[model samples]
Target: MASKKRIGLYFGTFNPIHIGHLTIANYMVEFSDLDEVWMVVTPHNPHKKKSTLLDDHHRLAMVRIALEDYPKLKASNIEFGLEQPNYTVNTLILLEEKHPDFDFCLIMGEDNLKSFHKWKNYEVILERYSLYVYPRVSQGTIETQFNNHPHIHKVNAPIMELSSTFIRKSIQEGKNIRPMLPETVWKYIDEMNFYK
Candidate 1:
């Protein structure tokens, strides 16, 4: 019998999938024990305001484009069909039940680790899945606090200060956003006039 592949679930709105997103995903696969990383595109994040979201399909498409060159990375729209205001715990539960063969881990930035306790059913998450946390700028305090969690693993990747919000703002302001995202993703965003 063959062993099941280890999968990491990287959930995000990915409002516009940028190079930073791809870089971290690639880093996880290249440097960690996980065999593949799925960029789980959430339809809507419970913690974020809806007004800030781009269309889920568009965001998912951007993720696909951004990861096109990396065969180990995939874009998942699993939450698109689920109910709105998606929670990580619920997604984890569903994926676990649906695919029991693969070991699952949650990939996140240290910034998210700070307010993790406020997330719905966070304790359950901590108990069930391992967390791969990457360091981020301005993440000093939160990273220190989560260092004690049994399931938590720290990852070091080049810190790209770019963010979706900054990309969106650049687009809206008619500034060039080509440098912030992957080439394919930038082309797709330009063709679709996304964030404009």
Candidate 2:
């Protein structure tokens, strides 16, 4: 029998999908055992305000365009159709139901892992899925329980300090932050006058 495909689900709002996002996704798929990395464009994040987010389709489009050249990378709008205020655990359950042949894993930053214990059903998630964590510059220390956990793998990928909020603010302030984004994505954002 053929082995199940290992897919890494990198969840994000992807307000505009900058180079940092692409770099991490590319690195995960290429350097790790993951067969593909899906840039899961979240439509609504329960913690963030909705007013600041662009339309769901717009964000998904940007992710799609940014990943055009990377065959191992893919854009997924899986959360777009899900109910609002969705949790990661719920999404994982749904994904498993929909694609049983694919073994899904979560790709997150060290900052997020620090608060993983607070997530709903986090223990259940750890039991079923593996987590691939990348380094990030953020406050707070990781929980002692997660230290050397068998399911958690910390990758030594480049630390990307860029943020979508910074990109948006730069555009609104009339700064030329073109190099921070993929060329096609920059063009799309410029043409649409987004975040202006």
Candidate 3:
């Protein structure tokens, strides 16, 4: 009798899942029509190098810790079981089969949007799901490319210029990363000695 929750799939490596990532997901849940936002952690990106990535399980754990306070936010390890060189199209299709009752949308930063055309099965992705894009500290090239797509909507989230790469670098250098992530997440990272 209860209605299924509308889920937004926010796929990313999440390398560390910092405050900036949380801010965008929170904004989407609060401001958009979606009922929840799932941080889908990708094991590996075909386009990105895996050399700089932290362990997938560790990254997922950090995401869980970061989102513990928000009941509507969840961290998913769906890609963990999938074969590597993770592709968004495949992940979306699998999620569709597994969670049939929930409505799904794709969430990404403007930077991803710009390079989305180069993604595998990009056309299928565009046709099947709506895209919710949050601005990042990058040139406005992505916005321009998809300006005509009716399914794409721009989100007005806080401009947090921080990044996972920055956090990782800070940790490697033995600098404090508390200011860049949520308190609970920072605690986990510190306790586990992640990125060190």
lDDT of each: 0.84, 0.94, 0.85
Q: Give one digit per residue, the lDDT tens place, for model 1 in 1-196.
A: 7887889888887888888888899999999988999999878655577786877778888898788789999999878777766678888888888898988999988788887888999888888889998888773466354667789988886776888899999899999878788998888888887778
Tens digits of lDDT, candidate 3, 1-196: 7777778899887888888889889999999988999999878655676688877888888899899899999999988998777688998889989999887899988788888888999889888888988887776466355787888888887777888888889899989778788998888878887788
Ten consecutive residues with minimal summed lDDT in candidate 3?
A: 137-146
Give the CA lDDT, 0 to 100, for residue 89 in model 1.
Answer: 83
lDDT order of candidates, best first?
A: 2, 3, 1
- Which candidate number would show the highest lDDT if scored against the true structure? 2
**Which 10-residue span in candidate 2 carries the lowest summed lDDT?**
43-52
The local distance difference test score of model 3 is 0.85
Decide which is better by lDDT, 2 or 3.
2
